[model samples]
Target: MPFVQEALDGIEFARGDPNSTWGSVRAAMGHPEPFTLKYVAIGNEDCWKPHYRENYLKFYAAIRKAYPDIKMISNCDGSNAQLDHPADMYDFHIYQNANTVFSMANTFDRTSRVGPKAFVSEYAVTGDDAGRGSLLAALAEAAFLIGLEKNSDIVEMASYAPLFVNTNDRRWNPDAIVFDSSQAYGTPSYWMQHFFSDSNGATLLKSTLQANSSNSLEASAILFQNPMDKGNYMRIKVVNFGSSPVDLKIVIDGFDRKLLDSSGSKTVLSSTNVKDENSFANPEKVVAQVSPVKSLVEKTGTNMDLVLLPHSLTCFDVLMKSDITQITADDDSHVSSM
Candidate 1:
């Protein structure tokens, strides 16, 4: 209660202060405008604190009265339990093994549809499976992201934690990007994020897989628009967690052979072993490799070969020449060429 105003002052900027204000702090330091302040989290991983709820409400009320437009995040998993105080969003963090995190891809599939949207701010496959940024951990995280993309209505925000780890420090290892005093390089987790980044603001398509294939294969399709040429594309991301390759055949309902171009790309993140990680000396050992895929489609929505490697995260970006006015699939629109 004693730290309410100060916390609000630091979070949303105190309303009645001139000498000690966020705007003035930015200007006095020689910035054109203040930093864009919209979201604020009460605390991180403070769900078990007895005074968390008490302190949270005090801060919430003060900030709400001053800045009614800002969204507040609560440090609790509303999916597992109910919240006493209201929040704009709820914080859900997970640090599990590769198999555990991969299976949690559908964690939000059955969550409550009402109340605040979720903010998966901290999540990663840690411990033995995530030893120094392994390919297995990246594939598991990619599967989880596909589930998030599918359930974007309930899950508003998501990100992997421990983005950087200095080799000398060596405390929070197996990060997305690793660095030392002089050199820095990305792990497989970093490359996996690049695939998901392209899907931002892109329209998620209505696509599904066979029931039997649900165990080891996680996939999602999106109508991604290229920002460069303003062209449309169909992106299919698949994560195969099994030990064997998946001879996958993509069937998009809607036959538009003329809509596709002669170009396509396949970005894969895999390694000889699922436990392979990148070290400072051998940084590129477990990174993703992008290679041009053969144009297997001729006209419209036809079956495309999306062979996924064993224990890999694969992204297939196919360029489309026209915008999709209708995404409905007719009898003739079935693309099963396998």
Candidate 2:
């Protein structure tokens, strides 16, 4: 009974009728306790449907009374029904080209009101395998992710929709992550997710680049303090959109170079020629490779400069010095406690 109660505590169920006898069946299914469901979506992409408004209202009223605390989300676009019902979260879908994705980020940043935080539940570039699954798309996805991280406080939650695509039974053109039936492989966009999720840091530091051309690269540095330990580190993600390699002069105004001793740099290059992706046969064909640190120079009162490859993703980790005076002072304070 305790296990059943725990399972039902936060479970959201989908059904048409609230007074329907199915509630008992849900409880009977190894969970005799009623689940404290919070949000329930009426339907997916209901704006295009014919009977969406009527059916949605029916379900909305019934579910509202059945569980008054449950928050309802109507899956409708900007329409009369959405304005009328006014659910907790309004679902919206956006499928656009690479350029459009960039524009959307700027729009979100400027927009004053998009009541019910906009959830970019579905979005991706479209076209044949050449365009949809191209390196350009991957780069666009990375840029969009940067915008998302910058605006996480406003955006509630976002997911790359239609996650899987079977090359055999193809339905969608481009997906953030894709795979085939026989072999499951990730697209270049997939790498963007892995890189972002794995390397997201706690503090976002301001970064800018001085370049001669508009194609030159720039990025914001993210500082992450290890949650489990006191280990502190930094990730410098450089987005180079230039047609030619730009010589980058890196500088951390506040941090010291002793921190970068153990941390190494990794590059994810999606060169125009290297757009080939992984298949069942060739899994590691187009993955990111560790580029040797060409030249690293550290000095006082100067920026660190290095030549970055043209049109590439470069990440650098700068490890924090454990023996810094402040760190040592804190350690001394803890030692006194012992």
Candidate 3:
């Protein structure tokens, strides 16, 4: 009980007012403002242990009484079942092979929405398929992220695990970023994350796909404002996790086709082989390539056809008119391959 109390006390010092005891100590160290600490997990993946629930209750009660606004996270996974105890969010972790990771994109589709929101704190494509961050692993993870984006209402947060690995201590099988004493480079998984960078606060658009190879494809569309240029753009992200190429025809509706700028962009992350990986010697071997939409697609209006490469992740950004920032999408947009 004392240990738990002390931990909560530490949190109060970190985020509480400067007049508080712990806050006073922090202020005395030349930092007067409180830190932004809003969420705290009771423990890491300790839900199965016998004493986890008992100790969790103590910590939960103490923190709730002290800080009602702080979101408390439980170690238990509430995706498949409801948790017996109360929590603002529940932990969900997954580390599997490429196929399993990709197929698990719909893992939360049918989850009970009455329980606490899910926090996917740790997830990665591991084993032989993810040899030191291969492109195959990244493609599967991208598909999984697309699913999460589609289910954003039930999922509160999600993050990739093993973010950085030092070559000196090569313990983990695959990581997003690899570094050493001096040089550092991002793996395919790291590049994969850039496709979703504009997702925060973005409005998701209704999108559907009808194709023979739909099983090997995952996609989502969103409208977001670029913080730098203050430009409103619609991004359609797709992941093809198969060997054959796909000719996809995108038909966007609900907005003025004339409003879309012809100078859009298409970014793709792929290589000659699906299992290709990036290393210090060849960091750019599997990096994403950015090109003008006109260079890749014949047309840039509401209807366009794109040839998606195998085991690739593609993002198409269509710039909207400067005056328009918020607009609802119609239900007629569909993904089809001709």
Pick the TM-score winner.
3
lDDT of 3 by residue, 9-94 (tens): 79978986889888988899988899999899999999999989999999999999988998999999898999999999999899
Better structure of 2 and 3 per TM-score = 3
Best by lDDT: 3
For residues 256-318, what per-residue lDDT tens digits would candidate 2 score against the true structure?
555554444566655555255555676555566666442352442225565666666677655
The whole-model lDDT of each prediction reads 0.78, 0.55, 0.85
Q: Which candidate model has the greater TM-score, 1 or 3?
A: 3
Off by over 4 Å in 3: 28-30, 253-256, 295-301, 322-326, 330-338
Q: Would you give me the overall lDDT of model 3?
A: 0.85
Error of 3 at 235 (Å): 0.5
Candidate 2: C-alpha lDDT: 0.55
Report the C-alpha lDDT of model 1 over 1-338, residue by residue, as the tens digit: 56876776575343333355665664566663545678889988997989898888888898888789889999988875567789999999989998999999899888887898899998899998888888889999999988888778778888889888877787885788888788998988888898887666666666656433558988887776678877777788899998888777766654455667767888888999988877778888887789986665653245665567889888878877777545444432222110
Q: After superposition, how far is residue 166 of candidate 2 from its true place, in Å?
A: 3.0
lDDT-wise, the better of 1 and 3 is 3
Can you give the lDDT of residue 219 in candidate 3? 86
